[model samples]
Target: MRLFSQLIALSRSRQLGRQFKEIERCIKALPRQARARLGIQTLREIGQASRMEFPHLYGTAPEARYLPWGQGTEIGYARALSDNPEVALRGIALWLAVAYHETKDCTHAALQAQHRQLLRVVRELKESHRGGDPVQEWMNTGAAA
Candidate 1:
């Protein structure tokens, strides 16, 4: 029984790890600006996925939350991209998968919220990619925009 439990835990970890790697790969393949936009979308998707997947893995549902980054998805993307690309991508991928899973596949609301988060992270990521240039900002300043 102990061995079985250990195996299950290990398997779960591996699965999540694999998912993260996939996301990282996707992120790395993106163009610089696209990477930020993609990261934002990826983050939002991951949040929703995590929420959906939580119940099966943990026997309880988790809530999806938005990252605080506004319209500056690129800033976060650039930051994460600058870090070991593989590591950052994997982490974000895992996050998105977990979020998607936690949400039980019903993520309209979460996705909407994440869309806003994505915009913010992208803008922030853009500036970072630009060496902190204030002029190089994401145009969509407001939440709705």
Candidate 2:
């Protein structure tokens, strides 16, 4: 019985890991799409390293949020792009998924407001992406400043 219980625990842990990876996958996918949209082949293509960030891995939260040079969609626009076979938006989708996940999390009751903000960000992200070329917008934004 003890062996069986250990096996069950192991299985459950693997399952949870898989679930987390799936969510992480979604978040990671968006940056790839954004990278393509930005036309980056290498870090040097992004210009001076001081100003631009090399595309970081998806799970790295601080780096994942921004496009090169601190620009890119910050809203939930991924739902729209994710539908596109090309030019997908994976991050915003996870932002919402994270929010939805939070809704079901054990900490849900305590973090209701934070979850709501995440949902709002997703909605705004989609709207923001709908406007003029996001790529151009990001590049143009704050360039003069």
Candidate 3:
């Protein structure tokens, strides 16, 4: 009985550690400029995007809660700075990492490939424009692509 209790406590501790690590990774993944651009409305939009793109990655219907937190909440927050190419790139990387960590399946590999393509597009956009509203640029180009 004591051994079982210890095991349960250890499991909970590991789960909590993973959650905290993911949170930290999300924060560290985005740059200062990207963080400045992100807002609640944008985050909601990203959440919507996550919902559309990978609903199955999260919980069941209705709430569709994301593991370690709510559905897309972490990714949405991390990816909110869509205007910043670095942010967008890092966000996808984080997403891929999380997906791989969670499932280690073909889906993870597929997303990895898809996001890699997206990173290239973002890099191109970043290089093309010298200085302007990144948000506007993303809306005009990144969002479409």
Best by TM-score: 1
CA error at residue 124 for candidate 1, angstroms:
11
Worst 10 residues of 3 by lDDT: 99-108
Off by over 4 Å in 3: 1-13, 37-59, 62-145
lDDT preference between candidates 2 and 3, better one: 3
Tens-place lDDT per residue, model 1, 1-145, is 8677556545544443454355446555666766655455555545553454232232122342232212122222344455575556544533443333433343244343443443454455444354434444445346436
Which order, best to worst by lDDT? Answer: 3, 1, 2
Task: Give the Cα lDDT of each candidate.
Answer: 0.44, 0.39, 0.44
- Please say which candidate is ahead in TM-score: 1 or 3: 1
Pairs that clash in candidate 2: 30-90, 75-125, 76-122, 76-125, 76-126, 77-126
Please, what are the lDDT tens digits per residue for candidate 2 over residues 8-118?
A: 545533433444344345544555445343222212222222242332112225645553212222232343245663333343332334333423232323344444544
User: Which of the predicted structures, 1 or 2, would earn the higher lDDT when compared with the native?
Assistant: 1
Per-residue lDDT value at 70 in model 3: 34
lDDT of 3 by residue, 65-119 (tens): 5443334335633563466765665554444333323332223343344345434
**Residue pairs with backbone overlap in model 3:** 66-71
